[model samples]
Target: MTRRILENSKVLITGGAGFIGSNLTETLLNQNNQVTVLDNFSTGKMENLLPFFSRKNFRLIVGDIRDLDRCREAVQGQEYVLHEAALGSVPRSVKDPMTTTAVNVLGFVNMLYAAQKAGVKRFVYAASSSTYGDSVSLPKVEEQIGRPLSPYAITKYTNELYAENFHALYGIDTVGLRYFNVFGRRQDPDGVYAAVIPKFVKSLLEHKSPTINGDGSFSRDFTYVENVVLANQLALLAEAPEAVNQVYNIASGERMTLNELFFCLRDNLAAFDLEIGKVNPVYGPVRAGDIPHSQACIEKAKARLGYAPVFDVRSGLREATKWYFENL
Candidate 1:
């Protein structure tokens, strides 16, 4: 009776009002699942859920994960938990390491504790490619890791460590998805800590020069949001016990330099009759806590969770560009 094999499941997505969380919420609701969104709206906005406010199976609770009681209440009667709440910007973390540590580390532990107590079926949370840090590996594998260069990376790594210990000690099933540069619709571009794609798109639209950090040589495996949603879905549905208590890299499995992204955006905009010529990007010093390059080895995810990313960087950028043109 289930459509797409995900009907009537009780799903909980922490930070469901944020970019990735909102996308996951809409996708789950479309599949006829009972969905609950736990968000404090610190970085997330209420407008993100404007489309699904009327859905009978969808509910939203404005609360902080740091509050254990609220976390427990939100986890009650939920089968799957997608914990995506955290202060995401590396630069912001560099500026305010203490707040980042408290929310990302302490709040994550609180959510895990509450989810464990509620007997959740699976815990799938947002890990990051930044966890690779200074590995210098071309395609970052799951087993090999390096010292975290940023506080944000450190917090995400801590999430995986906590997940492993929880499974070993408490028998809780958990999966950590190391998301690469995820970008697409609903990504906040107006903020100081905004991710690159949205920020660039906004800058280009406004005739402002987009700043490229580190001479645009620093590359990233820019992933789309849909791929991350697919990873979470697979992590929750995978029957192999080995899939649990493990981490998988969720990305397009390709790389792009910031310079390449800039030109691509310019060209795409030109196609829409928005001619932006000879866009000379402003160069800035390298960020305080940024890895030089990052790419992902997604074969392990394919082998274990059957995770397949449908959108590449170009495809995702095209989609995102269209969204910006229409919405902005």
Candidate 2:
């Protein structure tokens, strides 16, 4: 196992009550770091943070990112900032661009500016694969990107630009991790804008048919949350001048169609209950702002940040399925 790079530090996770944020907080707390979470709990669940409520090292700030004072208060004396607080979902963005822009764009700037003023060592924020809109590439790369297809994508790409500008102008070190479809434990499956993996798992568990937005042939580089956590750590560890102030794709480096993903989830969960295997999927119209395919070229991350994804999609699905079966 690679050694843990971040330990005994004061770190702040902006969306600490959310799935990826909670996972990062849990791991960091165990590694002997003092972790604080700033979340308004709009989409984040208190259930996710309930386990850590009693921990002396864990502090919770009940505030929204759109509030600059809250953002400033959260970053006080923090060595690093994992900026994961942003409104997600392309469909939701398409539905209400104003709300998405306010939170994902304006709120993002608030957090970034806060981290800068506090003299934080490194600011690592979550970018998105949606930024690779309409690009007909097999494996998406960092330097190459197409026009954003959604407001959410625009916000994420804007974040990249802001981070770069911040680094160039203010000299605050920043790293942007362009995460693909991230999933795992603590990922909420009940919301209207629920992610595909957990939503599918939840549906099958109830013996209900899950609807595929497209023909199910659209592929994605579905990354497991554990790999994303590791990438965050690596991004923190990468102190080289070139490594900082840049974005890297945090993904499995493999691709699978939505149909294959559904079957994988079905087959994995079916081992516990055969009824789950009998469940069928319903087809629906294609959603706006969704690309036909998405895969990542991890060579840059591997070479620059020494990031190697430890879990493939199937292995991640197995782990995520077991969690859903037990917890859901």
**Top model number, TM-score:** 2
Clashes of 2: 0
Per-residue CA lDDT of model 1 for 120-215, tens digit only, reads 998999998888888987899999999999999999999999999998899899999999999999999988899998888888887779999889
Residue 146's lDDT within candidate 2 is: 91
What would you estimate as the lDDT of candidate 2? 0.93
Best-matching candidate per lDDT = 2
* Residue pairs that clash (backbone atoms under 3 angstroms), model 2: none
The clash numbers for all candidates, in the given order, read: 0, 0
